[model samples]
Target: MKKKQLSIIENLIWNSAGSFTYLICQWLLTWIIVVHSKDLGNAGNLALAISITNIFFNLACFNIRPYLVSDLKQCYRSEQYSAFRLFTCLASLILCLIYTCMFGYTMDQIICVMLYMVFKLGEAWVDLLHGFEQRKMRMDIGGISLFIRGILSVLSFMAGVRFSGSVNTGIIFMTVCTWSFIFLYDMPQARKFEKIAPVFTKETIKKMLIEFLPLTIGGVLSSLGPSLPRQFLEAEQGSKVLGIYSTVATPAVFVQVAATYVFNPVLTEFASLYQRGEKRRFLKLLFKISFFLLAVSGASLVGGAVLGQWGLTFLYGKRIGAHADLFLPVIIFTCLNAMSWFLWSILIIFRELKALLVINVIGVIMCILIMFPLISKYGMQGVNDTLILYTCVLLVLMAVLVGRDIKCKFDR
Candidate 1:
């Protein structure tokens, strides 16, 4: 039987469902850990641990997913990409182990961190599969896979945390769920598109890494910029404060993910339009997408301001709900972040990795300059302020980069 390719709307729906489920699972898992754990400190430590691990994971993956999907010229086979991903994942796990030890965490904290890293590793692998599916315009398969993983992992996590009251146990259960979904569903689906065979070559790997190094650096800095506030909070205010911030920030993830779900289906079209010299159409589409994102973000900010406290209280209990004031700034940051992310997608089409790296570096510098002082003055509210400032800087920098690239292209 011939497989049906997804239309743009169908693709968006599937991707949105998948992203929505992932966000829900993320929020639920944090809620479980924070609400049910014996020690409240565990919530903050777990959040910090995940933040650190994600940075290393980006290093390991070397920003390869976008590179893979944008390989419209078919320079490398799916198996080759898989091989590269495997190499990087192993490296990332080793780094996670080393980094975890340096943190001087307690035994249980170490165990939870390691288990979480393993879980993230599984997700990264599945992401590579998603890249293949996306390149084939079969993002529905990737979306379905994410939805399944999210549901199963959340269920297993809830049961584990409830039974043992241990974040480590929950993480282990979630890891198993992730790996199970990957091997059983994700791999087979990817295989249906292209045969699986390990292809490892030093030359190809080295060349790919060199070519994409700027993007990898940009990705690393991107993660670092957002995380600086959490790091500062953990050090200056301790884990409890950081945990509170993490909980409050969870809603923002939905905005970022929703933007991706809406805009990503058309990413490949951006490249195609530009390459074919359909400059008018490309610019028109870009403007429309940007405006749509701004409008959605505006709506979210207003809605969050009005209902955030009640909604968070309803979902995560009163403890988390108390920080209702943090919701507005966080939502504002989310809107800016969503717009910045959309701009990054446009820049990706132009292969503006170096410009992105410079922009990300500027954002990080802004974060460093403001995060400590704001946190020192305003406490948890200060961290949100830092992030908002960082997001604004990124939005402006990315916009400038996009404009410069477009000007250069048309002038040539």
Candidate 2:
């Protein structure tokens, strides 16, 4: 295919694959918790623990995952196949061990962490596969992987019709299967890296590791930023309210998930444009999309939520909608926040990665200051208010950073 044709296909694949994966993970987790636990308190506890595990897995992958994607893209173009695989395997093993004993971990936490880390290793290969797909712009196969995961997750739910262990086990099995396929998908493309393979050395690996820091720290802190408020709420208002809060958070979470899928390929393209020194296109796309992102994603959510707040019913079910009123501010901000991703997306593309690390730190700190006190007094609403406040702070900071980035170009 020609270059433009290839671009379209790749975007198609990347977006579709991401949507499939997000839906699978969302429904699977949602049902597993609902069916397994009886009360909101127990369900919220389980959700909280599982969420920490998910974050821990993300941290576990942080060491080299992003670097692997970035470097693997370069290696594929440069024909350094063997070296790429060697680095991938090395990075995977290192991550597996780091998660094993790294944190101030408990014995049980350690076991679950290990199970989760294994999941990350599998996921790392998936990233490598995505890197390959993006290199060739062959998104179809990547979409295939997501479809497979989604199918397995749905089957898991259906199997719960007859068997009790169906939910978690099916989810695990789906995770294992998805990663295994991704690893297989990556191996064939490793051939493209053959020529540059021998030049790969310790120095090269170290450089990649260093480059990984900005995104890794940002991803971790960014992951924790929204989460910490809920932790405060749990500590103060307790788990029942937290569960209700999380349930009502569905729309925001789902939209964010969809945004992520669309954002990934655009991010890769953005990074490439930056590398190619295409400043004008980057800024234009950044502004246009950022405006639309906020308008479309924020509007329906804020409005639907206001009505739902005053009313007593849920479009999905009353159970999950009970605490919808308490999270209105959160519902609105989360929409705005989802759109706000446009800033970080550009940051990723611009390679102003340290911006991510620094800003998310400020965001987390701000969340602590704003939410912790309010959480004890007002419950989930307090948590919601804190999120809104931090978002405003971050929004202004992002605007300043983006404006500076633009001005720097003119100065040059």
Using lDDT, give the best candidate's number. Answer: 1
Model 1 Cα shift for residue 321 (angstroms): 2.0
List runs of model 1 lying over 4 Å from the truth: none
Worst 10 residues of 1 by lDDT: 62-71
Which digits, one per residue and each the tens of the lDDT, describe model 1 over residues 149-209? 8898889988887778777788888888789878998898888887556699999889877
For residues 1-412, write the lDDT of model 2, one tens digit per residue: 2333257446756656656575756555555565555666644653455455555445545533233333424543333333444465555456545644654444544454354455555655455555555555555555666666566545554454236543344445555665665556544543343232335766665665577567767776766767778766765666676667776665456555565566555555656656666778877766666665666566656666667654324333577656666655656676657655667656554467778788888988888777767877777777778778877777778778878876775347
Q: Estimate TM-scores for all models.
A: 0.95, 0.78
Evaluate model 1: give its lDDT.
0.82
Error of 2 at 229 (Å): 1.7
Error of 1 at 194 (Å): 2.1
Error of 1 at 302 (Å): 0.6
- As for candidate 1, its clashing pairs are none
List ranges where model 2 is wrong by over 4 Å: 1-5, 9-14, 17-21, 35-37, 61-117, 157-171, 184-201, 275-278, 306-316
